[model samples]
Target chain A: MKNRIESKSEVDVSLKDLCKRFGDFTAVSDLTLEVHKGEFLTFLGPSGSGKTTTLRMIGGFETPTAGEVYIQGELANDKPPNKRATRTVFQDLALFPHMAVGGNIEYGLSFQGLNKKERKTKALKALELVDLEGLYERKVATLSGGQKQRVALARALVTEPPILLLDEPLGALDEKLRERMQGELKNLHKRLGITFIAVTHNQEEALTMSDRIAIIDRGRLEQVATARELYESPKSEFVADFIGVANIIRGKIIEDNAGVKKLLSDGLEFFIPSKEGFNIGDNAILVVRPERIEIGDKARKSNNSFSVRVRNIFYKGAYLEYYTVLESSQEIRIRVESKSSSQDTSADYKTTIGWNESDSVVLTREPK
Target chain B: MGRVTVPKRVSLWAFTILALMFIFLPSAYLLLISFEPSELEKVPRNFSDFSLRWYIQLFHQERLPGAIRQSVMVGLLTAGITSFLSLLSGMSYRRLRKKSYFLGLLIFPMFVPGIIAALSLSVFFRLISIRSSMYTVVLGHVLYALPYASIVTLVSFSGLKEGLIEAARDLGASGFRAFKDIIFPLTRGGIFGAALFGFLLSLNEFIRAYFLSGWQETLSIYMFGQMKGGADPSIYALAGLILSVSIFLVLVALIYYSFIRYFSRSFA
Candidate 1:
């Protein structure tokens, strides 16, 4: 009987309480995640945060010490890499230097027992998909970094696996090439409609390419949400700190009125509207993004306001960034459009920073 | 405006001439004597009419031809066996680093002096009631060549880029398929070099052949006997032949090295 997982809409790849241990060290711990069909899910975290390990487990390069992995709804914990219907583009792009571009892409087709002519046709088509149609006879070692990356992609895609795993495939390219490849990869995913699980530590890359980003930390799953949800409303201080630059002010919750909570710092108060599960007298942190901290002499009435002395100013071409030290001794950074810095503010004077209560979030302090 | 100092060329020529004299003098002396027309008891104090009579006599001997044939057969067999076994063992060592200690034990016979190893093997064969012959001589030569072959192959295997294997497997190749398609082709240079070395080693081996041979005499053993029995001009002819063969082997090895260098440089 055919497995029902191949026909399901819920998940194409799923991990259940997965854990990997290398002797005394745990590389990944009790991780559970679901990758939906045709979704671009990214594992984003710092190095050694189990993001790569999780990706390897999904690709069948690693076997979890505990828990199960399901690929297309079939149990794949014991399956070898060759047996799985998943292909991985390694971080180094691992293109075979000994083979020509056509040879490398045609390799997997040979294992399928395709004849020479058929294999060549399929490989040419795959290369054409990456816009490298005429370079099939070129040696891989002679290609540029971006071309090598395209060859790697063509090699993996020629197998036509249901799920494609990319472990920082663009990490080796220069910034401009990386950006271009990122767009090309995203477009390829849309055109092919294959499930793509990419692992990267670059937060911007994750935010730009992923349908959902799973932020991991120190071998544990921190949060998995859409890019906007992770950026605008982070559940933990780690997620907020990891996704984007945010100034975290630690304070004690002084009062809770209905759902809004008022937090007291050293000499100031911050009001956050409707923080779930936060009680009065609880030690919490208020996370405010740098872009949200409004700076000007005009005292616009707002819920959270503080007087800060500008310590330094950075004039970027598009935006002006000001680093200020608040009276409470807390440092805050604010950014405004370069054209918005009027001549009056150009005199480099002290300023008042303000934001609405809903602009900030009260995040629980992570365990030490 | 700037100081100019040329490197001293005196010591360079001194070392070059000294090295050439040290390497070529003995071989040249043998070549000169091999062309001398003289009797067994007479040693030429001065130049005499050069002749090829000794070489002709050396080649016309009945036993010498059989001994040469036996030596060539033994060398070929030793090279084939040593090269095949070393390739397998070396590849295993490369793949399984944890098992290197076991491989070291397998090749430990290489550290023993050839004479001692030949002696030990002789005693072992006698205890097992196995008689010594050309087969035993080939076995002894293989023991001496195996370790050298293994070391050469291991160095070549270590130089390979690990990404090639990973890429092969990622492209749906089984372990065996990857080894055959990628690993073996990339290592052909090392294999050929090792085979040449093993052939030379077996061809020139003297002590091991001396102890292991029974009815048949290897070329080296026969040459040793001829040298000790009497000082003949024909002995000089035989010595010249051996030296020429050694030079020919060296030239072959140089050719192999050049091929490998060209292959790697062109592809790299």
Candidate 2:
């Protein structure tokens, strides 16, 4: 997945060790991030992972308990939302139900001292920008879901803020509508060239629409990188499990001067081509992506190979995923993908599952 | 979705009619007794002599008329004050960290006995040198109506999405501006309902009004005076008038609200 336009050179928003605590519970802790100008950055995580808390702090809804937030190189920690140069599209769209579509678009301009005529003219222009030019007098309750989304976008954009914060803006829409809106949002971001920082728990949405994704878990930053980098080179077991489906197998590293082997609990040796910062007798976890594993006897194509018993098979439309376990133990899961064109004979039998060292990540685990 | 047994449908209709009759029976009885033609009977037997003879006398009486006027004024003032207080309470309720505790604390006066509240308010008014008059009666009525208003407003606030306010602030509106433009308009229905409830409660209230109103006589006080002076034909006429006016006002408000809603939707 690729963003429509390249992120500009300017740093639009920066956080320096930001922390937010509600009494004894810390919602976001010591988060430092820099969002480039005209970039669409997503904060992706599961519920209660502090992704929303981080976005709310950026939007000035929740003040940081410590540290600071800078927007375009200016301190904005205490600035009220009205004084900030940013806007947000809420999850429910939050269009004023009593107001017409034009009224909603023109709401933010009144505080800027714009005359009514100028406001109306700007509102019309914004509606045109969002492709809702003729819906000035239509009440919000009468609009369709997508139209309401467009109205929300127009409302946020009408103020001409430099950055937009979207807190799960497409969470309420149906799947087909959400996908269409995602495309529209990408195109809108490209056409406007404004920074967009969205917070969502859906990994697919984050991967499909962002220049970079910051994965947060348990009020801490796990990893912040491009979607491909985060998926392929996750630094921790938490990141690997949260980003996508990963089979995390615990083992002990054994070095014999020639090479290193990850000794699995089932007495299988994973021949590691190379690894960093691991000594002999050190516990580690190997994360192999399901799509990267080969489910055949082609051990020459893979750096590390082993055999396991097939436990179950799930038939997805595009591929078949096999869940295999070690012969002596049921702890490790060997997930391998079988495409529709290839016949899979690994079910109900012992089969070899292998992946090259380049296709897996060896992460440090807490020793028992 | 369409499969409904006949017995369930019958039971639902039966329950609805039963509820309606339960609500309307007392009011029908009051209206019928008001047309008793100055008779001493508790129940009206003859429908032939239902007349306005006592109604003319009721209006001609000076004290009763003045009392009704005073009650109306006090009721209106109580409604206004109660609505404003309820608005503040409801907003605070939305903002409070412990909402349930704050809500329970706010409606604490409602749980106490009516006489106890009246006695405590009377003592407090005297200690503050606020003489017992129509203003004090208004104060007491407002206190009596506060819980109803607060409850209604809180319910309305619960129905509203908090995101609207955050969205408004994000759109560059100040806190006051956001509430003035978005929150107030959206919650007006609940406020209106609370105000009506306050007005009706104040109008019917007798215990607190009797104690707090020194020389200023409200409708209930005047009715008590007439009853003490023996059976008065004018009292029935006045009760009938109050009932009719209340019903008419309620009907007018409903019709007017529906009309406004219809037109507002039409414009959209």
Candidate 3:
């Protein structure tokens, strides 16, 4: 099952045909992905989707039941974590409770054969790198949650491994703190310019931090693309639905003419831009992003317009959500930025909503 | 956090006092007689008659010193062996799939009656032609104490997050190095608790010591023998000393445990 490629310096880590089975349950199955050097790649999936197991296989914490892991072009399937050129900031942070901040950071240096004084100097430098300059002697139990997270990062970074694996790195923080750490981590990744493969179930965190997002579902790799590409042009219904809020309209394509395709479902019709591999009379799926749909007066002038009954309007802080239903009784949620004071649609029960043909993508139905 | 009602508070205080008296009254009587100069007198005749005469007489007993030495040796050996084995057992439990079954097997000895266990061990030793001694006493005590020690160690092991070991290994520590630097230091409280359990169990052991000890008697066995052959005031003094030492050790252990707990809880 080993899918080896010619050694390339640009790729830092590669997994091919990776499968892990615990008894009758398969956690990760025949998964393959290539992580480029100096890129921030995230394994994004829902819980129990085998995202963490895939990360563990890359980090050498778990051996794939069948497949090959290559680190820096060398086969790493049998290599223990310590022997691999990778370090992980575990989900719990896993800071050594018995050691002080300096000692925790200095732990990896002990194996490097550095003298105690040199190790202290390097550990202090690493501490300063994480903005905890003077708290070298502080015990882990005395540090706050955010400080402990930074200490975990600093400890893993002190070893200077070529690849850093973060398993839900900010999963333990509060909402406000998590958002702040996301920015800090992105900046840290930029400054270090090393391969950072993070595993997270947070779609927003993945969207904000990752250079490339690999969406995994039920142990299979659904899609791997940039955040913008995944959001705008998802190849599968699963990728489109999992990456963000999407109104997935399932129907059979009835009209294929010029550069547009018309899909009919029940009593309604939808016009979307023609896409490859979708033929007339084929059951295809259409993915329209919530933010891409236009409502009220502006929607009437778009390529595909519909008059829908507005069920409700939700006032989110930065935007407004219009929960509308079409003639066929399908629910559609439209998100419109509330930058102006006149973006209200509460007075009218019937509203027009439409999206440009290019705003929605056509994806083949995922096999049941 | 709820306020206690008057009747409930009063009853609680009364129950506490009664429990304390139930536990300490007999020991208090022995402690009072430990200060008397004469063996026949139950208490000091007067406050001015109180003396350390019996305590001094304790050292003069020929077998008492040897018995104490033998007991201490047995306690130290039992504590060391039990703690080490229990720690290893606790570590293995994490990797075991059928954990409850394995735990039940390890705890089976604790369910056996002490007298029956001691008699069987004594018979087994004789059948093997192994003479009963302090070493045999230690073996029996370890068998009795290991279940308790392992339970304590398992409790501590449970507190250890699996991520810590994985993080250590990710940071380039070998398995042995990870255990030395992380696992042992973090779970030392449970290991120490196990050791204390082994030491105390071996010290207070009577039935197994009575069955396994040959020629030289343990302190408990020696004390029992003295009670049967005209009780000595020195035995009361020894009882008072053992009680005080045990209380001091327990107090020290409690303080140390709380200190570790406090340190661990600040961030948790």
Candidate 4:
């Protein structure tokens, strides 16, 4: 899939070791990434982790202290935002509070020297693209949160820039509106086929919308890959923890057998396929998702099994989350389907938790 | 939940009485004396019949019309010069990091007492051999009003969100164009309010006019001179007219501002 996307188009923008510093603090450090033509790439990170700063540099709002930026394969480090063929939808929307919807959308076109009739036609078309037709003369302040977001999108798209930058555009909306707008934005991206670079901290949002996700941490790019690849095979412990919830069990590699590796924890042994390269006596951790751990009479036949006392049970609508303490004194959380007939029998009998060898992954223990 | 007890509305009534007494008593006294039969007394003994004699005398008094004309001219000149200079200074102070200390120094004159400022300017004018006139009074008033205008504009400029300007630039506007379209319109309210305040301050100024106007007297100076000659009732009538004019101008400004605000909001 990656090769197919790469073969379809060339790169649109490239950042070469981009670095931004403020006094003694480094905001973005030696970052390099490429945004391909007509692809939706998201920079996923926590606040102050340099995602917004990187976007600002690409948008020409902040100059990189070091390195270069290339737009359409040309060096564009010194170019102002007006010269760059990119428009940004700010986090706050930043719609002109004194202008009507049409006026706001037409402002950029007028700067492009378009005639009044031409600008109005383009603005109405752009508004229609965002499903906000006939809202041209409505006051922006009177619009709801989702409507404001659509107007912001129309304002940016009316300029017909090659790239659209969105800085958490749906962050201010409620959950339901955010979900709906996400679908709308994805559909819009598909229809326009323009390079869309978005910045967000929500893991689900990034996984759901982005064609490729770049996870950043502490001013450094940790990993960049497809959403499924990132979630299924995280490159580092930070990526694993950030992408989703997982039970991380500290252990050391005891043996490497053909393609299977055996790891030893406090008093238990586990097996996993050695795909990430592990040797004997190597310190490792076993990352297991809660849904992958089975709790039933069928647990005895699994490759890795352990006895644990059920500590707590939380009832989710679709699944039951069970917090259990293993014999090794480490607490592990497991999720089982809510339809299971097993009652809270921990008071009478001990429970065994198990998972297949293929479901466990050996990860390097991250340094504190 | 326990019942929530609403607080008593004691301060509201107290403030109402205080506001009325503070704002209305002096004007009421002035109006009462302006209709007095005896022109030399401060208090009026009776109000059997109202007459416009004092108002007639006020308009026809010798030198009063000229004083009013000079005051208006000086006030206009002072407001125009002060607002323009302060706007430039304020914009510079807001945009340039190196001008903060300089702005602080420029604002020092506003904190000085009016009497001291007038005295200092008088000494400086004498050294330069510049005779005092309506222009001199205007210069003194400008010195008094410029700092207020600068402060107001500076606050307005600072309150503006930097992202709005960046958004304009990102939309293909040059730096100057962005400032013209975004910054100027957003700060227009502050500019107008500051200019009106400066005009009012200059019109009602007395100390600077007293020291700077060698022969030609402003309205405030003329009124002060009349106050020393047994409190003429015609002067009270003149004061009442000036107060009414100030109130009318303020009301007009308020109405104009509300109209603009409503239009902007409706179309936003």
Q: Which ten residues in a row have the lowest lDDT in candidate 4 chain A?
A: A1-10
Models 1 onward score TM values of 0.89, 0.90, 0.94, 0.88
Candidate 2 residue-wise lDDT, B146-253, digit = tens: 998889889878867788998888887788888899888777867887888788889888899988998879998888888789868677777778778778777876
Question: For residues B1-268, could you state the per-residue lDDT of candidate 1 as single tens digits?
Answer: 5544344466677789999999999788877778778774333456657777899999677789989999899999998888888888767776675776856786798789877999999999899999999889988998899888878877777767666676677667888998888888777767776787688899989999999998889898888888898766788888889889989888988887787665444235
- Model 1 residue runs over 4 Å out of place are A1-5, A256-260, A298-300, A340-348, B1-5, B8-54, B97-110, B127-130, B233-243, B246-268
Q: Judging by lDDT against the true structure, name the best candidate.
A: 3
Question: DockQ of all candidates, in order?
Answer: 0.44, 0.52, 0.64, 0.46
**Winner on lDDT (2 vs 4):** 4
Q: How accurate is candidate 3 locally (lDDT)?
A: 0.90
Error of 4 at B148 (Å): 3.5
What lDDT is obtained when candidate 2 is compared to the true structure?
A: 0.83
The number of the candidate with the highest TM-score is 3
lDDT accuracy of residue B107 in candidate 3: 91
Q: What are the per-residue Cα lDDT tens digits for candidate 3 across A203-271?
A: 999999999999999999999999999999998888988877999998888764564568887768888
Query: Candidate 4 has which clashing residue pairs, if any?
Result: A139-B268, A140-B268
- Winner by DockQ: 3
Query: What ranges in model 3 sit over 4 Å off?
Result: A1-8, A256-261, B258-268
